[model samples]
Every structure is written in structure tokens, then in C-alpha cells.
Target: MSLDPDFAILLRASADRLFFLLEKFASARVLVIGDLTLDEFLTGQVERISREAPVLILRHETTKQVPGGGANAIYNFAQLGAKVLAVGLLGKDEQGKALRSLLEAAGINTDGVFVDSSRPTVTKTRISGHSRQSVTQQIVRLDRKSDDLPDLDLQVQISQYIKEQINSVDAVVCSDYGDGTLTQPVISAALSASRTIVDAQKHLERYRRGTLFTPNLPEAEFAVGYAITDEPTLTQAGQDLLALTQAQHILITRGEQGMSMFNREGSAFHIPAFNRTKVFDVTGAGDTVVAALTLGLTVGASAWEAAVLGNLAASIVVRRFGTTTTTPEEMRVALQRLLEEG
Candidate 1:
């Protein structure tokens, strides 16, 4: 699909405005609440086959760890120079301490982070060889969580914290990775307190008014409770989600098919994915999109402009493997290049 001609024109006409808005990212304050994860990558060379099975054995050489999921969203905003406050549950373990330290190092406020002894901090491990192919992959995934809503005391604390900060921040982003941080009580607190944007990782019905919900194709389908295989069906699904969530807008990330946005007034806009020579890993591309969208809104960009900025940001992160965040300079350079090409 080609870029939307109207959107292209809008970008050209508002280039100066967009630049100004993006510059305001430095002053915007954002609050994020959701799942926090640690992404571990083991990279090595595939030089020999396993003796027991017909499998390539990787001689591991390097290990790297990065913040992932909702924490990644917070990191992205911090990279853009925003004042970010992150609230989530973490276990009392080495991984949890490391994640907290990482957040602090990135200049994110960690006051809202709470310790939960029941669950170990979530972690995802990936093993790749020199070929960048999955030679052997194992996930030490653990979800020591409960679905029961937060207790009255915890709910009160969360509500009070939001009320205290809502007026100070430009916007709130709900990065729901289904880790249970965004419980019903938390969603209710967000709804009653401020203007919010949600990355509906899986639970869609939790959305409410004064919020924007961004869900990928599979998530949108689940939100609408049907199968979406074509443009028309996808459009219908978007409308259905808008009705269900009563949100101001719904942005559906459709991978290579690009993304489409549906507003409360029933209007929709589509932006095709930027053509990339290679796509290494699309792991945290959605986080990049949601982070860009929240910051764009914070800087006073229109919904359409926010989506465009988001698409541009996602285009950059997917080219690299594993979880990653986009920087302000990178976004500015990419937008400038796009304008020059046009």
C-alpha cells in the first residue's frame, strides 16, 4: 500500500509545527503503569552440529540485558527527554534490583514501583547465532501473579498516587502486557484521574473514555470478538472496539500491512509501513509506537500526527534485533529524510 496522500500533504504543510511539537518532548511529563520485563539476549556463532540431534550448536560469546515491555515504553520516553514516572510490580530478587537500577539510571522516577513477593520479575531469554538465526531458544518465563483485583488498601494507594500526579503530567500511558499490573482497579483509577493512552496488549475491555487504545491486528480481533481478515472487516473491528472501549481513538498496528486509526467520530486514517530492506526483530515495535504516540500527544500534536510519528518511530526500532527504543535525534533525522524524499 502507498502512503496516504492526504496524510502526506498534512505532513508537508505542518513540518514546522511537527518539529516544534517534537521539541516539546523535552518538557513533557509522562506516567506509565504496566508490566515490567527484562529481555536477555545470548549471541554467538553457529559452527558445529549437536552430537545427539541434528541441531546447530552455538558457541555463546556475549550476553546483553535491556528493559522490555512497559518498562521499555518508559525508557523510550526518557530517551526523548521526557520526565517519566513508572509504576509496576517487581519481585525481591537480583533481576528486580537490576531493573530498578536501570530505570533510575535512565532518569525515570521509580517511586510508584512496588515490591510483590508473590511473583518473580518477568524475564524472556533469546539465543541467536552469528547467522542471527534461532539456533536454540528457551524461555524461563514465570508468571507468579494473581488475577484478583488489587486489595482495597493497594487500590487506595494507587488512586491517591494518580490523583497526586495526574495534574502534573501531560498524559498517562497504560502499557498493559497482561502482567496484571493494569487491573480493573488501576484502570478505574486512570479513567477517573486523567487523559490516558493505552497499549491494549491483550485485555481490551478494560479501556474507558478519555483514552486512546492501540492494539495490533490480533488484539483488535480479540477486542471486537471476531475474525478480521480483510480491510473491510478490519474497519468494522476498529469501529466495534471504539464502541466497546468508548475511547477517543483506536490505532491498530497491522505489521507489514501498516496501521489504521479510528476516531470517536467514526473517521479512520491509514499509514502504510515504510519500506524496509530488512526486518530483524519486531519484538518491541509496538512499545515504540505507543511511546511515540503518548509523547506526540503530550507535545500537542493531532491524533493523525501522533500516529505518523509513531509509525516513523516503529520503522526505526524494528530494523534492530531484540527490544529497543527510539531517540529524539533519530526520529528527527528520519522525518527530515522522509520530507526530503518527498
Candidate 2:
């Protein structure tokens, strides 16, 4: 597809703005709230089929673990030089402790992370073969978390911490993974505190005042209560979500088709995904996108500019094999290439 002439100009403008924004990221502070998870990857070789069943027999291999979901988003922000504070519920377990250690090692402030003794830490394990193909998957995904609002005592503590820190931060990012942590009350408290960016795991109408909504196609459809089969429908859906969420900006991630952004002003822009040979895994791409968007806005980039930066950041991560965070340097290179091509 040919680039829109106007979009070309916009892209050029965004590229210029990115240079300044990149510097701002070093000094920006962000608050992250939502589900926290442990992503475990077991890498091995599938030697042959099992005689007992039509299944591949995999040999034992190396194990790798990373903080994921909302925690991962916070990690991405911190890695990009942002002072990050993360608030989420974790079970009192070994995995939870490990996740906490990982965050601290990465320089994320975990003062807001609370322990839910009623639940176990959520963990997703993927077994991949030598060829980097996922051979099996298992989730010890624990949601023993209560849907009930956070403990009154804990909520009071969290609210106090947020009040003290909110004004000092540039942005707040809600990385909901359909986990019970991000309740209506939690969102309300966040909105009352700072400029909020949300990456919803599901359609949440109550979160309308969010500064930005980043939902993939399916999530977008769910948010608007319709199937997005074409551009018109997609545009309408974006508008519906923007209105419902009271958000000024909506970004619908279209996978292979790239992404489209709709602003409160009734203007929409689409940017195609960077051409790539293959997609290995798309685990943390959304987190990276939200991180980039929030960071972009903190540095004074307009909504459109932030969305474009998000697209560029996601393009690089999708081609990787597992949950990974994109660095600012990587984003800078991608933006430079896009501009040089113009």
C-alpha cells in the first residue's frame, strides 16, 4: 500500500519529535497497575512421537523466567530509564518472591505490590522445541484473587501512596490482564490521581476517562459490541470505544494488518506493520506498545505521535520468540530507518 502523503508528513514530524522524547524518557516517572504474572519458558527438543498417544516427545531443556503482564510493562518502562512504581497483587509463594526480586533487580519500585495470601502467584509455562515451536503449554494460572475490592487497609495504604506519588509522575499505565486487581474502584482511584493510559484485557466501559486505550482487534470488537470486518466498521468501532471509554485516543492493534488510531477529534490514522519475514511470538508486544505510548506522551509527543512510536516499537518485538521488551535504542533505530526511507 502506498503511504498517505499526509501520513508521510506526519511520520516525518513524529520522527523529529522522537529525538526530544527519547531524552525525556530518562527523567519520566510512571505508575503501573494490574495483573502481575511469571512467564516461564522451557526450551527443549522434540525428538520423536510418543507411542502411547499422537504427541511429540520432548527432551528436557533449559528454563527461563521473566516478570510478565503488568509487571513486565513496568519492567519495560524502567529499562527505558523511567522511574517506575508497580502496584499489583501477588500470592505468597516462591514464584511471587522471584517476580519481586526480578522487579527490584530491574530498578522498579515495588512498594505498592501487595501480597494476597488467598491466592497463588499466576504463572504461564510454554514448552518450546529446538526449532522454537511451542510443543506444549501449561498454566498454573492462579486467580485465587478475590473480586472483592482490595482490603480496606490495603486500599487505604495504596490510595495514600498513589496520592503522594501521582502528582510527581508523568503518567499512569493500567495493564489489565482480565485479572481481578483492576476493579472499577481501582480505576476510579487511578483516574482521580493522574493521566491514565489503559491496555484493557477486555472491554471495560467504565474506564472511559482513560487518556488512551490500546486494544487488539478482538478486544476492540468486544469493547464496541460488534464485529469489525472492514475499515468502515473498524472506524466506527474505534469511535464507539473512544466515546464509551471517554478516552481521547483509541489505538486498535490489527496484527498483520498493522494498527489504526482514532483521536477524539474524529480523525483516524492507519500505519501498516513493518514488513517482516515471520512472526515467532507476540507475548509482550502489547506491553511494549503501551510502554512506548506512555513514554512518548510523557515527553510531550501528541497522541498521534505516541501511537506511531508504539507501532514502531511493536513491529520490532513481534518478530521475536517470546515475551521481550524493546529498548529505546531499538526504537530510535527503527524510527530512523522509517524516516530515511522517506
Q: Where in model 2 is the C-alpha error above 4 Å?
A: 1-6, 46-59, 130-152, 276-279
Q: What would the per-residue lDDT of candidate 1 be over residues 112-205, giving only the tens digit for each residue? A: 8887766677766676666556554443333334555445666567666876777878888888888777777677767764678888667677
Shift in Å, residue 140, candidate 2: 11
By summed lDDT, the worst window of 10 consecutive residues in model 1 runs over 136-145
Model 1, position 186, has a per-residue lDDT of 78
Clashes of each: 0, 2
Overall lDDT per candidate, in order of appearance: 0.80, 0.79
| Model 2 C-alpha lDDT per residue in residues 78-197, reported as the tens digit of each score | 877889999888888888998999999998899899987776777776766653665455422333334455566665666666667788788888888876777666777778755898
lDDT of 2 at 288: 86
Candidate 1 residues lying further than 4 Å off, grouped into runs, are 1-7, 44-60, 129-156, 276-278
RMSD of each: 3.2, 3.3
